[model samples]
Target: MNEIDILKKIASNLTERKSTAALSNYEVLCNNIAFSHDLFEKGIVYLEFIIDHLKSIFNDRLSLKGDFRENECLHPFISVIPSLLLNDLEVIKKLSAYTPPDNRHGITIDNVSLLHRGFMNYNNLATATRQLIDSLVTDSYQLQLLDPKEFNYHVLLSLNSFEKYATKSIRQGLFNQEIEDALLEFRKLNFKDWKNSSITKCQHITFSNKVDHLFTNLNLVASEDIKFKNEINNLFKFSSEFTHIGYISTFFTSQAGSQVVFGSEKSPYLPSTENFSELKYQILETCINFIHKVYLPSLSSCVSKIFSSSQELVIEKHISNLVSLLKEGIKTRNNSYYFFVCSSLIGSQRIIDLPCLCGHLNKWRPPHSNSDLFCTGCGSSYNILAIEGDPGYIITGNGPVKVIGSEAPDFQDLPKEKQQEMLIKVAEFNANGSGN
Candidate 1:
């Protein structure tokens, strides 16, 4: 129907349902649509940023419109975001809101409960999608200022999270019916059937067989978006590089030297401004194409399938506010990420036993030697070493020991008196085998 007619129908429907719970259902459905729309807005901001960044880089280089070198840099984020967004939309579609037209066809308690389950799945997908969009924004900024190659690693991790949620949603949808059927099969039994046991077994067997049939038919329920499906298939193939060693792995690794060359001697590897401009062009093209052709449809389809035209009109009333809130949220959440890696030699470390305050011997180890050295016996957070008495070293059998590991804090790091006090306590503990 035309826009005017659709609005009229929506108005009529709302007036007709003024006193009915369908109005409330429509309201709730609009909220869910708004929530998904908020994520879409955030994602759009990232895409626009990438597009703008590309324009700035390539605006001066019209001569290099079609250069293809270094295009690999743009591939990960380009394919990853759209694929993940499409998957998220599909999960949302599974929970399409239902409002029966008449009393005879109204939603049942079971349907309401099932819808709740679907909402839970959609909520998880939405959160994970937001995290990915946030990561992409952060990565995009970092790419400009730091290592551009790090973008792929961040995208790969986000893809892992997105895939994890998508798999969970699929499993939840797939097994929900089987679980209900299994319960129904159990309920349809008498005392005699229970005593027979074989009847119960047969029921379970039938349910198992049906599950197999459902698995075979699952492909029929797959997303109708061919590009989405193709992207998902391609994504899964390339995602393995993050988990295993291969070519994509090398994309993030530092080169041996700037002088290293590849391919022909005549062409001897050198960075060109044209190639860089082409890379920017590729980024721009991919982001624009995906945003228009893939992301917009996916978001529109999600909202379209879940809400009626009347409810959509209601959502439109708040679209401006949603967009503003999305912008505020993105601005607040745009912060740099700091991460640390442990490269110390873990093999040479000795597992020192220390007494816990709780009178357990397995509790404390010196700081930073092993983070995982919690007490398994007493469940204490760490092993506590209790040192008592005068500020002098109590001699061990072989010698006076001040510290254990070289990585341990320097004795001079503490005040001279405090260092002597700690050493005396350690020596006392060594001599008596107990501080308390």
Candidate 2:
């Protein structure tokens, strides 16, 4: 069934069971749904702000010069946010499907399964949120400091993780010899110094030697207090448990009601009402904080850093204006105006590479949707077909000049130096176009 239908079914059944446990699940379910929707809506708002700002800064830089060097750095991180947001949505859906194991009969097994799924979804949601925060910070570094040592460290950790897991699977007979040999060959160069060490050596180095580096890289890596290290450790520890053992342990334990169902003593176990409620509320709070405190602020910083190179003061002014509008909107209850102003301020400029006459690349999302064009900065709309035309005019000394498509230029028509410069610009634009 669809998510809406499932939500409706839960709501209808909530009233049927007035027992304390059943009532608590209903309340928690309602809260979970509400919290998820709030994040989803806010994510939409933040995403619009982020993408529009990226486009604006890109086009603004494009207008001043033919070569925009920073575009490549912005693409990878900007492309990461939407998928993370999608992960949040999926977690929300699972939370909505979960029901308390109050009726320990025909529905008990399904409810238990749903609860386990919710835990797994929450783990994924948390991971994605953390990664999004990290990516934004990396984006900021690319713009301001241009240091990539930490970025490469993350890359090494990721590759090492894959190698470690692949080797483990091979040992467990989960991968054939050919696959094992391929993985070993891929790791050969990386393993030169630590030839006898386990493949997880990089992972160990990241956690043990790079804690300070991580904190320095991103404010969200840990809490901004004395207990930051503890918080980071705890977060990773809990996430690991949730990912590997928590779901399976749920079936074997009788201590609490938080979504486990396996046991030899299987006399239809369920967590205590209080314990179950606690777990549910904890997940809700984490999701909300991740969105409000971690994700949005880091994303804003990333955008500001990328655009601040040429017009730092102007970027700050626009952000201040957006904050003021948001406060006023909250006071006057004009959410539409607030969001519009936010979009206008952030997306004041359009992407240099997109093909819309308004010169704005508006709302290109929901991958399957054919109708993803609606400009908030300018009251103009276009379809995917519009992408074929020239990008909007750029401010030039002579006046605003329309940008000719990069393809319009013949490479050999220019001096050798200019030709090389043109090739670099085209390559940068293509990288930005891919945005990943």
Candidate 3:
């Protein structure tokens, strides 16, 4: 049957209360239109019309089941329609002020509650769509329009809180010294068992699946937008260098008993913490722009074509309100969460050391030494067996300063005295350096 005729028949069935036949027709319509973007958009309009009609018919009749399925014929129709409506409503609410006049229009709370049990069904549907999109991207479906670079960038940005927290932990010395030492122990762990660890395996599987899905979608839409294609290609290059090659190099170097050189010559695109933060901000801005300039407008245009001309203003206003709300929501939500996580990870500990001008007797040690005799606070090295008892040494390198144990005082019980002595030494070092 023609689309208009089929829609008319479905509406008639609803009016006549022929639930069985109406549902069957609805199911057929839904199934046929499910994959076609154009058909899906039209179907939503038809469903919205049917919902309004049903509300008008049964508004005073309290006998109808509260479930969406009672009025809708198909299972998927009942399941999906409420969410679409709610999603539409949420976008509207977000875009527009819940001011009294606008609030007075559209479905009332009482009706909405009775229809979908108080919860907006659209959120569930949007979540489902997100999941489906994720799955499609992971499966490498060429027909999908998603860009993995943009998608991954979004996901990483979403996890900004996690990254911030991790960095904070490093800066604050929050980790136990023993835990830091455990790196040596971790190296000795069996490779077979380590490789098969649940976390590692799961991460590998998830990443691989996502990459596959992303590539498939990329291939399908490669010809649609040259800019998008170029972005995707750059993203792939970054991922290859940052994740694949960088990870391999780190693993081998760490295993080889050497420091892993991160963000090195081989992986030029791998961002440092500062770089990652900046890139994340840029990506978020770009996504927001894309959504505002491209996605929302395109969807609105399609919606306008399907709906009544008179309703255009209302729909457009609703969409604008929603886009604004989403932008604000993302910013507020991410900022607060990111700050909390990062602060927790990187505490407020300040590291202080003696300046070079201090002429305090300073003991020095070779750049590479294994001893707990270094006082990080004063940048002094101590030797217990010096002829004068304890000889203090000061670091004199352009790199990070380290304390040597030989220069530290043996007066453990005289904490105040030891601090006073260190201050005097610092004064002398400073004076001598100033003269030169």
Candidate 4:
């Protein structure tokens, strides 16, 4: 039948159920397409920022592996984002970001194999998922359009198979020997009797469930986006049975269920937190989760070598912000969480310029020795050592000025009485502005 005949048949079928004409299942699916791009764009902004942050820190230190540059951490992110073409995804660089050291280096916190393993897992999963999505859009759409009279149900079968494939790979990716060995044994049987097995009793879990499992294993957790969770669960159920459509004449007429609504009722003109696609959000979050579990902690490990309470707090807060951003999206941006690095983590030494009058600064010589101090603001030099007994007070044109500088070794080694005598002399110099 032509398009008009198809519409008439849909209308006739809906009328029989006493329902108004509604979007077919495929229409609902198509309407949700915008969810993918908008959400992925926002997600990429954060991912790029994160990659840049890692590059700024570890890129210089990583070793080049083959043609893959040591510092290039964008491979995984690029692998996921929408691609024009990706035929060779299987052979793509998945471990380039994880080059090992040249020598037999002991695996310290700074060089944890798990950290690199996290990146490799992330890259590999994204590669597989991207390829599957490409097939979903290209092959699935083509198969569906071959003829309305005979759309391929096998495409939907492949879709079901691919989701389960991803779910299984994710389970294996955990790298837990116990879990791996158990899953390995199960796979050997082709999961023929998996339903009777102790581990899950044959129930298939959604992506969010796998993520939760990962977090539980790692002793870290993130809040789930309920809508995202539901969408993924629902998506897997879209075509659960391979023989479903063969028995239903309504399959072509109702792509999704009849009661389902497509798109949103909200006005587009208003500024709102962009709604991300469930698939895109999870994919993006997977990348962020890897960073959270491995990259940030590795950075923290390197940073903690130096003892600084403020720096530690700052870095921890930074890590927390990143996790929140990934889970909550731009909602976490209100507090400037997107910054790659914060100044507080730098723990820089603060210096007061000492207000030079002629824009000139030079080390002043004391009669006793060269203090290597540069505190003179006026044309005449002041006896700064007078403040050793009291760094809290310095005599000057502005009366008493408190000056604290890094300890002057020469002055620190002097006798207390001598220092006091010098203080008295400085007091006299302040009183006359000429007596040293």
Q: Return the top candidate by TM-score.
A: 2
lDDT of each: 0.33, 0.39, 0.32, 0.33
- lDDT by residue for model 4 (270-357), tens: 0011111233234444333343453344434433432145444544444444444333432221121111112222223443233322
Candidate 4 residue pairs in clash (backbone atoms < 3 Å): 25-255, 25-256
Model 3 RMSD to the real structure? 32.8
Residue-level lDDT of model 2, residues 324-381, one tens digit each, is: 3222222222112101111222223443233332223344432314344455544545
Better of 1 and 3 by TM-score: 3
**Clash pairs detected, candidate 2:** 250-260, 250-261, 251-260, 251-261, 251-262, 256-271, 257-271
The TM-score measured for candidate 1 stands at: 0.21
What would the TM-scores of all predictions be? Answer: 0.21, 0.40, 0.23, 0.25
TM-score of 3: 0.23
Ten consecutive residues with minimal summed lDDT in candidate 1?
95-104
Candidate 3: stretches off by over 4 Å? 1-225, 232-271, 320-436
Model 2 stretches with alpha carbons more than 4 Å out: 1-40, 63-146, 156-224, 227-232, 246-274, 290-294, 309-436
Candidate 3 lDDT, 99-184, residue by residue in tens: 11111124442333221211122223223333322332332221122222333333333343343557765635655655345433
Q: What are the RMSD figures for all models against the true structure?
A: 32.2, 18.6, 32.8, 25.3
